[model samples]
Target: MLFRLSVIIVVMIALVLSSTWSVNVQAQGGDEPEECVEFIQQVLTDLGTNCAGGDPFQGCASHPVITLDIDEEETDAYTDDYLGLWPIAEDALEPEERAELDPRDRFPLLPAAQVDASRFDLANEEWGIAKLKVSLPHYPVAADQVEDTVFLAVGARIEDTTTPSDAYFPAAPIDISTTAETALREAPRANADVLDTAPSGVALAVDGISPDGEWARVLFTTNRLGIWDLAWVPTSVLDPTVDTSDLPEVEQDSRVPWQEIFLHDGYEESDECSLAPPSLLLLIGPDEDTAVEFWTNELYVKVRGATLFMIPPSGNVLMAYVAAGVLLVDPDTTDEWVIPAGFWGYWCLSEPDFYGGRVPPEPDEERERVIVPCADGAEFVRRLPDDDMQAWLAALLNPLGEEVPDIVETSGIGGPTIDLSFNNSDAIDPVRDACELGQLPPDICDLYEFPS
Candidate 1:
């Protein structure tokens, strides 16, 4: 057809013009002839493929990882105004001189990382376009190398990550009773504006305790502001493990949200117990934030409120070898120990539910009160003595092939579930009628038993 003939004529004209331009540029001998040839070849290739399809240069430049050394001596050329690519001299030169030429002189050095180019020059074809900008990684900048104009390609893939070693211990829970009435204030001082009154037995998140052990920064949700806020409260109301004198000062403006506290829905403002669930009650252990000054390495159970410090025995040279393997701390420096997630190498205990069962029975409100029925498969918190705990720690650190003693069982808090039933029948006297009627038959008394 006539349309097919017209397309052939247009292609021939483009090739003729490219040939003419290439010969004139080669005669001048300014830049590399191959660069011009390659550019033309690429244009023809794109026209054959992309143009034949639809978009000419769709998604071509977005994937190559390119790096370049900045021409520091030519810093004057790279002002804020000249963000676009500039030309470099390509006259007859030695290898050293060629190295000195700026990379932008040969080809444009696009920065895809630091800047958002999705809707800018990359998307528009009015400007001389090669390929998609976002298809490639960010251009590298070597600020420490040559001070003169130097062209160097050194691309590196940088990934942002937070490892267990680099994780920070942001805040700890305040061990205060629900009955203790304390005011959370806007400032660290007593006369500051009162934000909210925290009732006792509700474990609140504490950022830092004051040096004198008189005040501490605690987080609370204020009804007045209708937002989560950090405020100061008296230290006397909190049950802490370490001396307040050792705690670092918390900057009033630099407070971050405690993730665990923000996600916790176990306790409300009116709850009697400090914890959210009865299952979590058994996880109550030592307060880790308070022990930072004395212990170098510690294992913290965030939800269970337990922290077990790794304190290896001294005086023996072999102890160091053992300590090195287990302890993630360095006593020489002031670095605090941080417990990673899912490290269940410590003793734990859970408080019994409201009705007396497998665990040490709950207190009787009155002698006249009737005993509640026990659930099908009741479980109690596995406890170990102080000596047993020390022995377990010693066995872990001991280089010698000592027989490991099974002292404490690991907690089943976050582990596999178990049904607390005896032959599929309720084991306790007060089987809540609601659970008894359920299809799965709730194991009200069963608990998770972690491996020791």
Candidate 2:
């Protein structure tokens, strides 16, 4: 009995081993083992590879993780030096006056030497604080001692994630300037009101600046009436500049003039409605015949005396409509017929349902032509020719009307006749009005009009 039990146990063990081998074989063949290992490695790495020897499972052999220790003394000294040069005040100043102030006095300069491993926690796992570095030129206090000092500020938020068990790796450096500015603009601190208010109109045309200058200021005139703030930084700071040598150059027109206009349709205090005010109106032709007018409520453009177009700040769709019709020319392109009129209205007739038919059969010359019902019995049917026959028939017999032509029985000759009788209230006045105005029918227009 004991020998029999041993044999049974051995058989059971063999079966279990066979099952395990089959499972491993299936896994290896169905899914790549190397890819699975790689995915697992990535998941482990993301879950804080704080273990030793570059392996999270091991301790003491890995490279040491860096942590930040903000230098309060250095920061304070930098702030004082910067503020001493450009003192901020509660009163708002003009752009020209602000430009006259030294940039060194207004903005703190970042020290290249101070950038160290400890200054920036390279191994920080939190996305918010992982790559946090101090941005200089932060204005914490309003300097009452200086006049016309402009302050441009940026800030950073610190994050903390140094634990080995954490499930996130260090993030790349991110700029919170826009976010900081938004918050400051919306609700500024009591002492930081100067940063919130935009400078008044005072143009300062920036000639080129010295290579060593800390800041560059520029000014341009606007017809808009309101407080405006202009920040000047090198174009490289905003976006990467494209190399022009590879691109073909176009001829420049010295006499080509452009004008800026501030068009206002309505006034409201909400964030959506905040807009700058009017600028100087200008005329381009004889006796103000081709002139642009800017007022508080309306913006008017008169081309000679025959055509006058008024554009409200809101609901400006003339450009969009023209673009849809291909009537507006693209200033960049030399090709005149790039856009064709009525191109927007053209619809492809290949869609089966669009013509009220089943999927069309493969192209064959011997197949009998199919006749479909039109939505407007005679009028719609009459319009169908060439490729549009299917569409017109679909429209006519849309609801399986009783008068559907007998096309199904007659092959191509006749379909069930669709009812063409119109109710007394369905007179064609609305259609006439639409045709006269060069627009869709009144019922269709009402269906597609912009929501009020």
Candidate 3:
């Protein structure tokens, strides 16, 4: 009973001393208060280490191996101090243009040797290295800024303070994204100008991360001079294992005969057709049931059970079917057809064996043209210019053609997948003019929403 009373009295004495010491050093104007000094002495003594007299000036001083914050106030102060030290790029500077920029930005600048403040919590150990809660800046100023807070370690080495039992390592090749629409800003701060928005799954390359691991310096593509660039994003939205390290910073411009500017891959200008939107396309399915669907907003046109079509940019439709008659119908109502994968394979009129059809039993001596087997035996020829009519019909009605599937396995569906390289610009204009004049079938004209 006497020993227990003595223990309580000692604790009371220490509390009184601690309170007095805290008051004395409250206005000392140093980053660490005398209160922290007392806490450090207690921590070192508890660990069975003697700092001589427990005097910071006389004995060993705190070396700041890491940081720990006591409450909400210190966390905010730490976050502010860290941001002032954050890096920024010069105006109009491209991340790719800089020779100093490293391709991969690993999170937690230091991979290891960091510990959280909560590890130091005990009965009376309120002071230690401050582990601060921080939030990195995001683009477009997000509406809810509270969810971004993350715990980060800050510290100093002590004479004999206990080493953290738990150590954390930063994410290797850091990657991040926002849950909703978030902008990639020019600088790593909320007030910085917004460069552009990145949708979910638009993978970004990590270049660097803030000290607190809250903000990430990310690489992005832009429409400016150098094209590839860097921006800041909040670490909160980072997706796990989503690394884009191999993607090139500056996308190589694709060469086309028309546009000098670099276009994305899988696109090239045609020497035959006049300048038109790349959206103009043709699709051929791998099977006969697969349908051919055109796109220009509304289902512009659809052909079911048809292997081939002669499409001109003028919104006119001419098609040929194999083993069945062509069914031109409204885009939405068309069934028994899947979108064509590409134009070059299977349904290509130029390929001799792509379709099977009957040959004309007799030749047209007057036109000097012979009927050739095409479109699985059903031959329908549209009158084109006198010069192009024979060659065009011959290409369509490939008499020596072999059986081909409706759709090819390896075809792209968007836009015109077929690589039509015809040099006959004159023939295209006339057919387009005819279609514009409503000379085609009613259902075919209806695709363009032309007045019936």
Q: How far is candidate 2 from the true structure (C-alpha RMSD, Å)?
A: 30.3
lDDT of 1: 0.26
Ten contiguous residues with the weakest lDDT in model 2: 146-155
The best candidate by TM-score is 1
Model 1 TM: 0.22
Model 3 residue 61 distance off true place after TM-score fit, in angstroms: 77
Q: Candidates 1 and 3: which is better by TM-score?
A: 1
Residues 315-337 of candidate 1 have per-residue lDDT tens digits of: 00000000000112221124322
* lDDT (C-alpha) at residue 149 in model 3: 16
lDDT of 2 at 125: 17
- What is the clash count for each candidate, in the order shown? 22, 27, 40
Of 2 and 3, the candidate ranking higher by lDDT: 3
- Tens-digit lDDT string for candidate 3 (164-271): 111111122334555656778766677888878888766665645555566666756542111134577776666745553432221112111111111011111222
Task: Name the lDDT of candidate 3.
Answer: 0.28
Worst 10 residues of 1 by lDDT: 315-324
Ranking of all candidate structures by their lDDT, best first: 3, 1, 2
